[model samples]
Target: MYAATTIGGGLGTGLLSFYLGIGVAALLRTMFGYDAWDRDFNATIGYIFGLVGWLMGVGMWGTWGREWFGLKIKDPHANSRKELGWQRYFMFNVDHKVIGIQYLATFLVVFMTAGLMAMIIRLELMGSGQDFISNKTYNTVLGMHGIMMVAVAVAAVVGGLGNYAVPLMIGADDMAFPRMNALSYWLVPPVAVTLLLSPFLGGLETGWTAYPPLSVLTDSAQTFWNVAIITFGLSSILGGLNFVVTVMFMRAPGMTWGRLPMFVWSMFVTAWLALLYTQGFAVALIMVTLDRIAGMGFFDAERGGDPLLYQHVFWFYSHPAVYIMILPGFGIALEVIGHFSRKPLFAYRYAVGAFLGILGLSGVVWAHHMFTAGIPNYLHGPFLVATELISIPTGLIFLSALGTIWMGKLWLRTPMLFALAVIFNFACGGVTGIFLADVPTDIHLQDTYFVVAHFHYTIVGGEIFGLFAGIYYWFPKMTGKMYNEKLAKLHFWWMFIGFNLTFFIMHWPGIEGMNRRIADYPESLQTANLIVSLSAFLLGSSFIVFIYNFINSWVRGPAAEANPWGARTLEWQTSSPPPVENFLTPPVIAGHPYDYGVPGAAPHVTFFPPAVGSPAGGGGGGQ
Candidate 1:
């Protein structure tokens, strides 16, 4: 029956292996006469072992790992393969759709968790000094909120929506490496669990950046935080590689690059960004970890190590990591806009070029994030120019979106409304970004609430809006059911109004000398603080609507038509909720996806097998 390989078995084995890992590290350290009781050293080693155990326990060992040692791999879905409903999602099933749903569901929980932390932060800041929690507690909450939100922003769209849609869009049976795809998703839970457990081990005080000497010297929680993020970065890199490979080699016959859907293009660029640039964060954290566990002097001033080095490494990844997050958001927004606008995508090639442009420019703009961190004046001009210059490509996306909407028959569904908000919200974020990109203004507003406002407007306004759009747009396809349109719209307007209200006022306080990352502010700012806090609660409450709608609709909503949007994309040609192989017949791309109202356009896809031994696309699905 293979009853032991479900999530339950994974948890049991994970706990056992976690203990074994810690105990072995302690034993080895004792033999070497090192500090066996050292929390940082032991925890770091223990986490590595725990991560592996968890992955194997969750079904990887039976399904994939056994192949490494000449043993037959067991079926991952043996226990519940016959039932084939909810239980399959709990194990390491190699279905891209299942993995996508897992990623979405997991990260949605992470998003809400972080959002609640944000409200708690807003609560503390609503008045002044020492409202409830101490400064240390506030910092921990802030850091937790920052990191978790960043995680949600980074993975939710690409892992969740990208996984589910890309293969189907490209007309492939599954990802090029299905087990590896499953592996990337499985890596996520350990990262999340490790991060959530850190506060109990003295908490993470050093914000998401975890910069330099403070991170190097903080308690074991920082160690856990570092390890968790490093694990997350690995997941990102692997997922990126998988996406790059799958899109390259796994496409249907005649699914040429130019004919690829906009969302797929966005993800293609994002995947490259992830594969190539995620190393910046991983390397930075690894140094921090080595410094903590091995007594390395990577950032030790006494040992002539440069503290500024860490900032450089971290932001190098962290900044482009912004694009890594937002590009997919834009991708989703553009996609929904295309289908709902009932018009051909405007400047399609230009939009694709813009994606490539962002990819080319993303790595160079990393230094802009470090301007106020003490860099040479000579370096400032180049970074500022580079930072602002990247906007040209992004601006093309805005043009493409607006152009599609102009003079078109608008279907303002929940997804479309949310998609439209991406442009409106990101326009504001982009304008504020100019101030921060300039050297003088950045020096003044470096750690202020203005930066906070701009950051959220860009990520939450632009990307989070895009995230919701993707959720709504694909809900019918993914669940084989329709959502409540009325409830969905209610959530959209409430969240839109509340989000703008909360973050827009947040900019005023920054301009008025309210430093960010603070638990306290002057009494003069109390009124504005209260308004933002109350608005934040409103923003938080909107998710309740979303949660209820998402659950109720999925469980009891009307069955959806396969081609609900009447779009030309290959995915829509398949059954709603799709088949195990994605298509009853193999799909073949015929022409571009968004040829709406082109009078005599070829259908985007047709059913046929791929040519035998096609060279296919570049890149692989492996990490």
Candidate 2:
């Protein structure tokens, strides 16, 4: 599909669009200023214009551009299935499954790249005083690692797994808006490329938060970072919106709200979080971008801009963004727990209620990230209370997990193991979070490695582990292949042990007052840092085992049976890897999604193959 024609899906076309954008940017700069050698000006313009041309070159114009202009096209959903082998993955395909695969492949690649960046950071920290890279380079690597991983955390599961699974689970042929789904996904590449290309533009060092004054004074690389963030926010907002509409309107008949799968409910709540709060962070980034490019100085204290104002706007979305990152993880964990334990989700309605409760509390606790930033004294008490109170909903997730596992069959499969690990991991992370939420303790731990350890416990331990659980649990259904379970077990043990050794020990140095974002620490902390670094290397290397297993299994593993786990969700009713239309006819929901042990219960969804005289199975499905 991506031939080298005017409209195709080829790297050559992407490059052509790229160079065209650079040329347009250069031309405009020359016209606007006599001195046109400014790299910042050229880079900003070229980056923006390049993505436009890249969009056109990628067949976006041919697919949705005509639709935007209200013109009809022939076969709008063409090439969605594997009509041309794996090339559909690289093309502008409209199938939710293909898009989901594309997203999974894309973000995993980014994750590995960012992981390499993190290894570089750990190498420097391993020895103390600037082991290899310069402090400036170290800072850049650290910031890039932070932001890229943030991108992975924010988008990987929700965009990748959610997009693929939601339609199938809901018994829909496709997303409520398939074209819009494609659009949301397509926006990601250019923005990711822009952020990845920041190093050549002097790199960004203001950290992922990009607090201003530092951000305002940093090199023009920050401009690209700003644009990347705003662009990503736009994509996230659209994705969240698409998920909500699909879930709310397209579920299988008899699948009431209470009958919805935990993962779908999680996505539904996550979508609301994304829709309502993502713009706060986007607006903050936009203001900073304007400060960099347009000289607006919204955060420049010298220009009467309050730097604290940036923190307020940034954290409003960012703190909720923490929930945005983990809520889906919670859903995934519960889904795995219920399936593998041979039980219905414990307190299903309460868990659903807790998800909503978390969303309601997410916004009020934003101020907690700013407690030590010199807010009013009276406000601190309420903020602290709100932050601590959010943990009630968080605890309910754990309660449900424990309750479900009590006296259950407890299949210790890869997914279940990882699911169980999530509870353990998030427990440690959440306990520390309570300490951090208290004003007195936070004052002591502020800017220390304790904070770092706390978040990694939540994000890496909680979210990433949950991500792997989802990947393993859904692997058979998504790809029609069984992963090497032994290798997956090895991956889990290596990662779990190494993860604890690395992050758990990391907290001591913080308690000993090791500040974060620093190139060097006290000589006394060197042994601790080295141990953390070495274990981190081990933790990082465990991914190598996973990658090999993921690839080797996808190509050569045993074929999976439909409904391998005997899952009761609507998705497992369809074929493994699912058909192009998901269901030949719309699935008829019969009962609760996770009523696994219920005696004499019908399947959640019953599938009938396509009628003999109908179009049947030529990748024939509706939008």
Candidate topping lDDT: 1
TM-score (all chains, Cα) for each model = 0.96, 0.95
Steric overlap count per candidate? 2, 1
Among all candidates shown, the one with the greatest TM-score: 1
Lowest lDDT sum, 10 consecutive residues, model 1, at 612-621
Which stretch of 10 consecutive residues in model 2 shows the poorest summed lDDT? 1-10
lDDT of 1 by residue, 287-325 (tens): 999998898999999998998999898888988889988
- Relative to the true structure, candidate 2 reaches a TM of 0.95
lDDT assessment of candidate 2: 0.86
- Stretches > 4 Å off in candidate 2: 1-38, 608-623
